[model samples]
Target chain A: EAEVAQSPRYKITEKSQAVAFWCDPISGHATLYWYRQILGQGPELLVQFQDESVVDDSQLPKDRFSAERLKGVDSTLKIQPAELGDSAMYLCASSLTGTGVSYEQYFGPGTRLTVT
Target chain B: TQLLEQSPQFLSIQEGENLTVYCNSSSVFSSLQWYRQEPGEGPVLLVTVVTGGEVKKLKRLTFQFGDARKDSSLHITAAQPGDTGLYLCARQGGSNYKLTFGKGTLLTVNP
Candidate 1:
């Protein structure tokens, strides 16, 4: 089965350090998403991308967090000066298309971040 | 903000037992999707329910959508150890596909 791909399955960084995660959606998928999952909680959307354009980033912390998909195929999410409260599982998901409805996301094996 | 409230945050059952998890909300949704996640992994899609009062069965598992489209339920019959995982319910809000998720229920099927 085709699946979304994520890099750096695990990460450990200090409070003042920076961290980055990458994701590659399945071929032909036009919609990609980045989410953060705290322990014992469900994943929350951080950003959404439609090809190379951003669709929604209302939940994203723009000040310290940033994401981009240059070619609209692969994406990267970065956090500057990671905080201890930022420790969580970063997940990436992709869908065929995020139009009206009927888009089911396929998630990748997430990257776990632990900030001390 | 759209939110989903899941009941029974945690559950444990012996093998061959039955279990059910619920997701509810005051807000209406166009569709609801269920997912299962194991330790250290992202959630995997289980089923998607659309329309009111819709029921779909997958082998020993059954899913139901509420008539108001604001709630959904998942039932597992004769659950085995493999059924142990965190089950999450979510729905896409707004015009895009940014899914709002419930806290999720962690199920442990003991042998």
Candidate 2:
């Protein structure tokens, strides 16, 4: 089965440090998403990308977080000056398309970020 | 803000037991999805319910969407230890195509 790929399964950084996570969606998928999952909670959307353009980032903390998908196939999410509260599991998911209602979402193993 | 509320935040049952998890919301959704996540991993899609009052079964697991399209339920029969995980319900919201997720139900099937 084709799966979304994520790098750095775990990351530990000091407060105010920068951290970045990468994700490669399955081939032919046009929709990618970045989510943060706190302990004992569901994943929360941080950003959504349709192809190379951002579709929604309302939940993303713009002041410290930024994401980009230059070629529309792979994406990178970066958090500058990470805070202790930023510690969570960052998940990446992809779907076939973003036109109407799509059911399935392929998710990666996720990058667990811890700031101390 | 769109939100999904899941009931029975945590459940622990012995093997071969039956259980049900629920997801509810006030707002209507175009589609609702159920996912399962193990420790240290992201959620894996289990099923998606679109039409109202739809019922779909996968192996020993049965899924049902409410007639009003504002609620859904997942029932597992004869659950085994392999069924242990966190189950999440997500709804597609707005034109952004972003998914709003529920807090999730953590199920532990003891052997």
Candidate 3:
């Protein structure tokens, strides 16, 4: 099925602690995305990456969050001093490319993060 | 930012029943996609509608795009317990495959 891969399916951290999640997109996919899904709500984009460069990060909170894809195949998202409000499901997705009008995206099982 | 509104945020029906959910947007969509997510997992794409007034059927599930390109609907016929999940409607906005999703409609098909 060639699915996207995510690590640490679940995470629990206390406030003021650091947490990190990892994702590996399907082979040959050039675009990757990170999203946060609150309970009972749809996923919201946190960042988008094209190859090794960031395309958009308008919704990402810069102060405590950071993401990077050094080789463009795998990515990591980190949050320092995690807040209670940061509790959510973190998802990673990948697509063949991101230049067209529309394309199919494959999602990973996701890492559920909980900050107490 | 574009706003998407989904109706009937939650629904529950007995097995073999029929139901429909809707997704409406404040801005016109160039393309719309539907996804289904089960508990403890990420969303899976169900279908994509690109043309105005387009209709696509996947077995017992039927999807329709509004003629004005601002809304879409998903209808499930003879839904079974396996049909229970959260249905999400998403639109491709701006350049480079940026997608904005609706809040989603949670459906529970009781057996």
Candidate 4:
């Protein structure tokens, strides 16, 4: 089975430092998602991208958090001046399509970020 | 904001016991999905219940969508230690591009 891939499985950074996570979706999947999960809470969507275009980012903390899918196949999520509240598990998921009855998302192992 | 509420935020049971987790929402959903997440890993899709009053079975797991389409349940029969994980339910509210997820139910099945 083709799995979604993520990098820097674990990270620890001082407050105000920068951190970035990478994800490569399954080949040909058109939709990618970035979600942040605080300990003991569900994953909250940070952004969604469809073929290099952002579909939704209403919940994204625009000031210091940004995500991009430059080519629409692989994606990067960056945080500048990370804060203590930014400590969480960042997850990446992808689906073959963002529509229809087959819109099941496959998730990567996820990147755990700790901002002290 | 659309909200999904999952019940029994935490559950613990002995192996071979039965358990059920629920997800409820006030906003109607076009589709509902259940996912399981292990420690240090992202969630994996378990099942999707789309229609009102629909029931689907996968091995020892059974899923049911409420008649009103705003609630769903997952029942695991003869649960095992391997079934210990976080169970999340999500739905597409206004569009397919966005998903609203419920605070998951954490299940711990001890052997």
lDDT of each: 0.93, 0.92, 0.94, 0.91
How do the candidates rank by DockQ, highest first? Answer: 3, 1, 2, 4
Candidate 3 versus the native: TM-score?
0.98
Residue-wise C-alpha lDDT for candidate 3, range A1-116, written one tens digit per residue: 78999999999999999999999999999999999999989999999999999999999999999999999989999999899999999999999873454568889999999999
The DockQ score of candidate 2 comes to 0.83
Candidate 2: give its CA RMSD in angstroms: 1.3
The collision pairs in model 3 are: none
Checking candidate 1 for backbone clashes, the offending pairs are none
- Model 4: per-residue Cα lDDT over A1-116, one tens digit each: 89999999999999999999999999999999999999989999899888899989989999999999999899999999899999999999999773444577889999999999
* True interface contacts retained by model 1: 0.94
Q: Rank the candidates by lDDT, best first.
A: 3, 1, 2, 4
**Model 4 lDDT tens row, B1-111:** 778999999999999999999999887787899999999999998988889999999998999999999899999999999999999998865565577788899999999
Query: Which DockQ values do the candidates obtain, in the order shown?
Result: 0.87, 0.83, 0.88, 0.72
Q: Each candidate's chain B TM-score?
A: 0.97, 0.97, 0.97, 0.95
True contacts kept of 4: 0.75
Please name the candidate that would achieve the greatest DockQ relative to the true structure: 3
Off by over 4 Å in 3: none
Winner by TM-score: 3
Global local distance difference test of model 2: 0.92
Better by DockQ, candidate 3 or 2: 3
